[model samples]
Target chain A: MRLLKIIIKNYKLLDDNFSLEFIPKGRKNIEDKEFELNQIDDNLYTFATMAVIGKNASGKTTTLEALAIAYDILSNFKIKHSLNEIKNNNKTISLELYFYYNKYLYYYKTDLGYEPINDFVSFKNEELYNCFYYKSYSNDIFNLDKYSKIINNTVLPDDTSIIYTILNKITMRGLYYWSDFELSYDIDKIIEIYKTLDTNMLSVVVNLLDEHIKDIKRENNNKFMILYNDNTQEVKTKKELFSMLSSGTTKGLFLYIQIITAMLSGADVLVDEIEIHFQRTLIDNIINLFKDKSINKYHSTLIFSTHYPELLDLTSRTDNIIICKQNKKRIIVENMYDYNLRSDSIKSKKLYENYFNTAINYETLMNLKKELMQEIK
Target chain B: MKYLIMCEGPNEKAVVNLLLDNNLLIFNRNDLLGLDIYHARQLVPYLVNLINSYNCSNLKIIRIGDKFTDKLKIPESIKHIIDYKQILKCHTHPELEILLIIDKNLFDKFNKEKSKIKAKDFAKKHISLNGHLYDNTTQFWNDYFKNNIKNLVNDIKKCKKIGKNKKEEIYLADLLKK
Candidate 1:
């Protein structure tokens, strides 16, 4: 399943109507410089990176937050916390996420705001299937809604969401949604399919972990690598994913491996601040992997936010850019792909400059270096 | 050795104009950025890099920011840039200082507001720069407190905390004193 487009309305300064039309239907701009924009279908999300830029207090972060919340509304079935109880539950926060799976359009919308207006998943096909929305709360799936920048437009059907509904039933382990949520998903159905994956892609992840463990044990003799928590079942299982290694060395190496793992999982991956806790060079490496879409294995989608300006040289087009800026009262946010920019020239620097401007504090910079030089020599 | 002297605002402009009028300092307004709007902290890196980049050992850069501290913070990336010495937050109220101490006729010329010459002359008689002296740096309000220069300077120093936030109107005062 691939997200084709997203609509943000009255949520943050995205209060205005905005849509990121990834799959351009009936639109012809072959000159769009971006290969993703030239696609004819209304469902394929070909763009690998989404860079957000804006002045201070701009709706940049808010825009991503709204989309994350939208997925949370659909994926989780039961939640003690209502949509409004979540952060920034606007009186009418609604989203129409368009997903395109194998050339078919599926939409998932939720009125997490007020009055619960028409929150349903629908397809235009002759068969109308509406299994309850895929929610993030009160479900077994852990959807990191705020940080995930996914297109909800083309969400897959509930049955289609599980790798195999009937196969994974006998086994308790495989890909499960967030454990804290009470997911009614057929755990038994997915377990049988889990057996198909242990050696192929799963073993590769284990090798990466094993290699990391060897590297760590070679460097540091007795330090505990895989720290287990008795109170948390998920932690115990996830610790196996960690090699016997120091957190810092394992962190950057582990993250890139995780990116590969996510790609192998055949699921939409949402990573916020892909630049965080990683070296700039390592970030470039991860981004390079996503950019190579022709070699994509699992039919996965990658949506991420970053603040590194050196990142600009790595992107394909400004269409993948989303800017969120603050207005006098609210955050002004819109997707760069759909912004109807008058001239292409004014926008080329918009995305990176947005990141650069926030980080450009000259006064503190001067004193810090001045103090550091004194300490250095 | 080329030295740059920066003013906080337009009053600093006027005060420096007056100080130049009294033949005190040797610099001009064009030496600073217009509208006093460029960031105060960013100036540090530019200053630090300028000397080496241009291959000049005697290069200098100076700045005066009026409360830009509340919004712009200096970045930490260029922490080793050691190009120029900074004399920041220097002028107390360079403009108002001109008004408090400079001759009254010079103050009216740059005040931007107009009043009768007779009224201006009457105000001039009440204030004099002859006996004024700043115990450390003269206060902008010393004219009202002192019969001698020390009280005037002390009073001016007193206004720094209160009036430092205000734009200096000293250039106008210098014009009025003229």
Candidate 2:
């Protein structure tokens, strides 16, 4: 299944009526075809990778987290974890998700409300529409009344997603989500999971990041042996091995393994702070892994957030680049395609120059300097 | 209705802000998308995106610049979405500093030596606000005309001779509320 679009309202820092589109809009550039856009139907395509970019505290992580929650609710038939994450006093959060499955476009809309009385959150309202996929239909598939309403306000489990319950009967591909905080906690689990799978690519990734390591071998008792180029080997626990390796090498290894697994299963991989502890070329290679059709036969999507605008230069189409900006505590998400950009203009240059108003505020920096000077005095 | 006012430079931006501040323009500040200084050619994608985002049906683009020779070429990517008729140019002939010269009642002196000195140079030499000389900055122009908006409006009106050329150019006075 491929996600086409999602509209989130009153969720976290996102502004009301916040929408993100995965499909291309406006005039189609023939050159964009060379990019990794997966064709779902005739003339209908979804991006293989989407990059979320912005300045510090501009809600890039929030957007990724929201997508992760949306994906979890859609595929896992659960919103208990999502409810637990809500710390705000907001009464409800509404979401409208569009995805393609089995030659059909499914529109799933739901509202999750916080029950203050019981200190719980549950689905307040739900609706689902199934529209037959067609190239000519384009955006007309969004017209709810014109299509078949398979589910509407049906009473179901408070913590379960209606669409997930229905879609799970057929089979739903789960999404892989990773954040900076989850890395340390999931390191051992990820190592165990990697042990069951192929270790050749993991070794390649480890070697690519840190050339000092000649080989990495997982032993019988969850211990790892690292062989240095000088023919020195040391046995260490999972935590010790991770600590012994550079942070970049550890992250690169885990990210590569996750990407390979996602590609094999054709599931979407959502990662926040993807540029942390990695070089530019390493990030570029990871993006290309999803873009390369031969390597990614299942058309698994890679959705990641980054502070590095230069990484956006890898994308050929503007729709795949999501620019998040926070103003007055509200997060505004805009697709790069919505900006007036010259076909030949460098994406990173525009971002660095504050073309989209996503640059850091000089006034804030001055205020920080003033405070620092006062404290020093 | 949505109005996108594209200034040629910071001085033009200051003048537009002054006009908007004094409620001289027909469209109020709320009707404005923004007061940007991006050139018309470079602003196509931004404008097209704004139109798409706002779903603006009655949108007008008022280009405030000294030079209108550079035509706005709507690329094929956005031609169908934006109409060429919606774009209007308000030229500040010669330069926008002409307003400062006219405001200081030095138009005759500047016109006599127009061949010798540019209006900007003449304004820097002659015009001053509260004993402060004109520094050729947006802040200077804005402060110079802060309390003298009526004089600024009159100066724009008196500079009609500068727009005499048959170049299909509109003047700043034409934007004022009739």
Candidate 3:
């Protein structure tokens, strides 16, 4: 099911009064400064560019990790047990996800046992991060077990996207860009979205790799591995992420994976430290993966955090972006678009700082005006 | 009549061009730019973007050499490639297709002596390629493409993996030398 919306109550390392809103393109704005989840709808930004800006340890990684972990557990729980049992079905965690698949509304809540103890808190600790599905109040309006919207199978695997299941076209496309390298997946699960190729385009890609992959696999079974010095050495399946690639290479390929692999196979990624060790120009190159049209639409929505303000030009309204700032006692978030009051593509964040955070991005600086004047003159 | 294709090695590109030219598929100086294929991990995505940008509707993608079927543990969907298959499939090159020409001998080599080419030996061979790839990456593209001599094409109707994307990537570079 497509996760159109999610509302978080009292959670660890998060704002007690925090609720992140995902407003879909053309959907009514359901997000405000207040935190509440009364009516989740089709407009929530499930599949769009979502930027979470915050100070170091401002919960940017935590927020993403929580969501990633939740989804990872849920997708795996239906079949294989997770590495951590206690973490798998925790009773004290509270989270709720509101999503839509095939234009049908669905809500999944997990009572990870955060309920009775804290009188100040709601009722229980519940979570449903990777949990996305479609539900019909009337039951006659739509069917969750099987869908007819997308040409593919209606019933989706537990780990796939609820949106892909309902639409039966594409599913759980976790396009993750990392700001830090600490978080990433161990192995990639490839999926296909039956799209046509661009002729020489596929060959261009294959030309570069066809020979190398052959050599690597020829020496061994067709597995992903690393060739050490003189003897043979086999790496774990997910060697690319952990391998010692340059920051730019890692970032670039990760973005490429988010794009081509998204096209070749219907796989989503969980990237970490997207901006780490990357030059400004490299960072610019990496974001263009989203702009490319050949990518799978469902798998193209990326969820990552950044410390760079110049990267602001990559996104449009604040809806696609968020700023994580630390207030006196809690982490605060403000929309990059709404905070600036401008709806156009801007390098506003770059003007704010060599690094961009919401606090500095939205606020105007005197030096930038002087710089603008110098350029104008 | 202008089209460009990138391959990982001179031998791989030459094998395809030679076969194409021999079969009456005329290639001119302005018609294509042959890029020596490098790493599968990096090559595919870059070319896809280039194709999307140029807006070319008819382009021939010929990747040739050896089929290291053993190591190519790719999913069946991407396995076993054909010449110009990509160009044909995308309708970008409606009549065009993506063909991967590989050495038939290496298939047996990988099958027979796979253990001989220890992972470390394979890595060394990869590093030996550092000069070419590093020079290309560090140097400008125009200069890189210029200094690199065009590979000679010959006849190779017996090449293997003639219709797969994943297996096509394993073209045998040293096969011709052998």
Candidate 4:
């Protein structure tokens, strides 16, 4: 169960068409190298870590959020709207996701359009899965016989998607999004899950947290709290410990916990602003945790939006890079390898700098500076 | 055989492409790949890794240069890598080859009286000269390609009035035509 690609259209900053591939295509070099996904089947060339980069307000975060939308829709997480409403726009919102589920590739597309007359966009009325096969109102319209082996005469709710149905049938885990200072209220359940985790996972979290946290244990009151060394003043809550650590270290610990948990559950995780308050070395190390296929045992996938160009230096495969550039109102997503296509092992930092220096134009900034100079004169 | 035209900069790349386009070279467009190297010292190291890693059955690499005089200084830095001496011994793979395409002005620098002798010696020693380009400019390349200059020394003598000295750039749109 691995996410191969995601294509989003008419969703916020991801207007027009935006597509991302999670697998490297064939080329002179860095192409034939394949990633083994948990040894479930050899020769699977899926990327374990995917990084999205772009200039500020170029929709890097929006791209990750759009993925979160798809995951939420699949997991049936309630939202204010079926899809985020476009500002005074009636364009159709579509999310197409391609994932390998149970060794079979499955493409699930969901589209939502705003109804001007009714002044509302409802999921019930909109046509969902506008592809070859579809289901509506808890009924399978096409290829019901094909899914009989898994569904076993179980009928799902009308709102439940075939993707949701298929995901329930296999070990295909949904995407999990993490942020800074996010405290899960279900800490007891996490503690239970973490108790089963290897000691290496706990140590990784502690070591990344400036060595302040000695261990994580359950308190006498049946609450999960991190045990900090006595040299540090006693902290009453998780927030106190989080406050004590630098923003980068705190984010690292938070992400480490989420990643370890996700790896155990065999889930794919999406992160927005992954490089916030992190040093280049720390960012590289965090990315390597997911990029290194050997340590990524469960084949858990990580898709993150980052501003740190230095993170690019850590990537071995060119296809793992997705560059998002703003072309007027629309966002253009490009694969880094397609631009250079060099067989030489050029550092990603150099490639990224080259792309911006050559492919991208900063004429607007120069013009603005000139305009300000003229005004001063 | 697949050809990898390893060169110092864009001007050499343009010349190689021009020769390949005019059918003066022994290879076709599909059989050739170009690399614009920034550091000359890393050339052999890069080539060795490229050749060893290449999956093709038949791949021949040609090292192109800006001047015949440049080949006289084959630094110990490049010789230390992959043993330039052992290139002839290894024949299982398409052998690493060299083709120095330079300006006719370089002949004058090497001294006109001994220029032909030096050029022949470079060729015999596998040090230089299979192509003589007329300066670094697209106009020079365009004329050289259009006229179909097969012989290096003859072309260098004929196309003396090439162009104003400037960095040469390949016309990507024209080159894209199969």
**Every candidate's chain B TM-score:** 0.33, 0.87, 0.31, 0.38
Q: What docking class should model 2 receive?
A: incorrect
Clashing pairs in 2: A340-B45, A340-B46
**RMSD of every prediction:** 25.7, 22.3, 20.5, 18.8
| Interface RMSD of structure candidate 2 (Å) | 11.8
Using lDDT, rank the candidates from best to worst.
2, 4, 1, 3
Tens-digit lDDT track for model 4 on A157-275?
43445555556643325544444335444344444455667866676676666666676554433434555666343434544444555666655655666777666676777888776
Quote the positional error of residue B149 for candidate 1 in Å: 99
DockQ of 2: 0.01
- In the range B61-139, model 3's lDDT, one tens digit per residue, is 5433233222212222123332244421111110011111111123343335445763223322332232642222222
- The DockQ scores of all candidates, in the order shown, are 0.01, 0.01, 0.02, 0.02
Number of backbone clashes in candidate 1: 83
The better-scoring model by TM-score among 2 and 4 is 2
Per-candidate TM-scores read: 0.41, 0.63, 0.44, 0.53
Candidates' lDDT values, in order? Answer: 0.40, 0.74, 0.40, 0.50
lDDT of 3: 0.40
lDDT-superior candidate, 1 or 3: 1
- Which is the winner by TM-score between candidate 1 and candidate 4? 4
How high is the lDDT of residue A182 in model 3? 39
lDDT pick, better of 3 and 4 = 4
For candidate 1, lDDT tens digit of each residue in A1-377? Answer: 54555676666566556565443222323222122232323322345545665554555556555555433433442111234433345445555665544433345544333333533322222111122223222131112232233233444553132222212222111111221222223222222233344334533443344442222111122222332233221222223333333343444443444465556655444555566565564455455455433334554445565555545445435566666555467655455546554432334355444432444457878999999999999
